[model samples]
Target: MKRIFKFIENNFFVIVILFVAITLLYPNIFSWVLGKVHGINIMNLLLSIILFGMGTTLKFENFTEVFKKPKEIGVGLIAQYMIMPLLALTLAYIFKLDTALTAGLILVGTVPGGTASDVITFLAKGDLALSVSLTAISTVISPLLTPLITVLLIGNHIHFNPIEMFISIVQIVLIPIILGLLVNYKFPDFTENLKDYLPAVSSIVICLIIGGVLGANINSIYTASWIILVVIILQYFIGVALGFVVGYLSGMKMKQITTVAIELGFQNSGLSTSLAKTHFPNYPIATVPGALYSVWQNLAGSILAYLFRKYLNKEE
Candidate 1:
């Protein structure tokens, strides 16, 4: 049982891909499940659960570390907020994507760093503390930054009410995370005991979210699969490259560069998907880029981490 759980934790991206494929090929399965709970904001609920689990993994020390190394964290935050959104907007325009696809790609760009970046940093033998700090800070401020950037970048093309977005982010992300942190602080022992299970829980919820999004947009996905895939792939690699450049030019160490690269490259796509579903229901297809991105970034991040690990090992 333990090994099975471990396997699921380690191979989460694979599991996500399998489920997405299954959902796409047989949308009825998920659509039926979704229909059973019609009128419920399922994505919002799942995102809150995921954010709560993320909060449990965090410690107060993580926030203090941000002040301890403000420069590193600042560089990471700037790179994360700047590079990806610009790259996404540029790519969306260059690709001449329709409004929904353009908004989807840009939405993926505007969100915060994924919690998965911390794990990828550890796997790559990079700066885990820096990764964690970046993720924490970015996520904490996502409610503000995500909406602001989304509005600035694509507001003319899409109907986005930043105020509504702010409210949603607060409700779905900030509140739950704060609750989780409080639980962790108050019951350290209990939280620690359950820590190992959190990843599996998060993985399951994320996969289900992806499945739901894919299932909801199966017909549109069939038509725009290739183009959207290409745009998302470009968005990921460009963010990675620019992250490294920003880190190096800012005088960060190689490991810090690796950490920032991962952070910048991996947006909180689950958040994007959730926000898309909740706020942009009129454009269900807009969630597709984020859903697809959720799968591709993990694969790309893992491969990059492995290569970085091998190269770092050689240097050491």
Candidate 2:
């Protein structure tokens, strides 16, 4: 079981890809996982579980790290909120995606950085502290930024209430994180024991979320695969390029630059997926980009991390 879990952890992106492929081929197989009861979507429950796991891994020190280096964290946050959303908007227009795809891509841009960035940053010999701090701070502020940005950019295309979206983010994200933090603080030893298994569990939950979304929208995804793929690829790579530019122009160190680049490039697509499913039921295809991104960014980030590590090693 340990070896099996280790394999899953190491090949996280591969598992996601395989699951997504399988779902696309056999939609009903994974589609059943989207079962709901009493008007509540099962994805909401799974998302809460995923967020709770994320909360357990965090510590008070992660928050303090932000204050310790406000300049670095602030720059990272600025790049995150500014670069990605605007780039997404540009790509959406340039590609001339319909309202659903445009909103989906923009939402992906607006959300916080994923924990996967921390892993990639570590692999690239980047500043783990900055990565964690960026992710934590960005996540903490997502309730305000994500909905506001969405409304500002894609409001004309979609009819969503920003207040309701804010409340949903708070309920799905902030509250779960706070609960996990309290548990971690109250039961340090127990949390420590659980931490080892959290990654594997979280990876499975993420794959399930992707599979559910992909299964639900298999037909739409097939029809729009090329356009969505092109836009998502552009969105990620552009964010990476702009992230490095921001860090470089700001006089950040290479390690910090690497951290910023990964942080800005990768997003918490899980949150985006949940938000789309919960809030924009009319546009089911909106969840497609998030599901595809949930797989693509990690694979791209991992490959980039390897190259950065190799280059850094040679320099040393």
RMSD of each candidate relative to the true structure: 1.7, 1.4
Per-residue C-alpha lDDT of model 1 across residues 1-316, encoded as one tens digit per residue: 6677778899998898889879868886665423324665776777788888888878889889878888899888888888888898999889899988888888899999998998899998889988988888888898999999999998887787999999999988899888989999998898887667878877888788788878888889889899899998989998888988888898988888888888988889988887887677688798889889999998898899999889853364
TM-scores for candidates 1 onward, in order = 0.95, 0.96
Candidate 2 matches the true fold with a TM-score of: 0.96
The number of clashing residue pairs in each candidate reads 0, 0
> What does candidate 2's lDDT look like per residue over 1-316, in tens digits?
7777778888898898889778877888867556787776777777778778778888989998867888789899999998999998999889899888888888899999997898898889899888988898899899999999999998887899999999988888899888998999999899898866778887998999899888888889889999999888878888998888998999988888888989988999988988887778898898888988988898899999999888853363
Model 2: per-residue Cα lDDT at residue 93: 89
Q: What is the lDDT of residue 82 in candidate 1?
A: 83
Root-mean-square deviation of Cα positions for candidate 2 versus the true structure, in angstroms? 1.4
**Model 2 spans > 4 angstroms off:** 313-316
TM-score: which candidate is best? 2
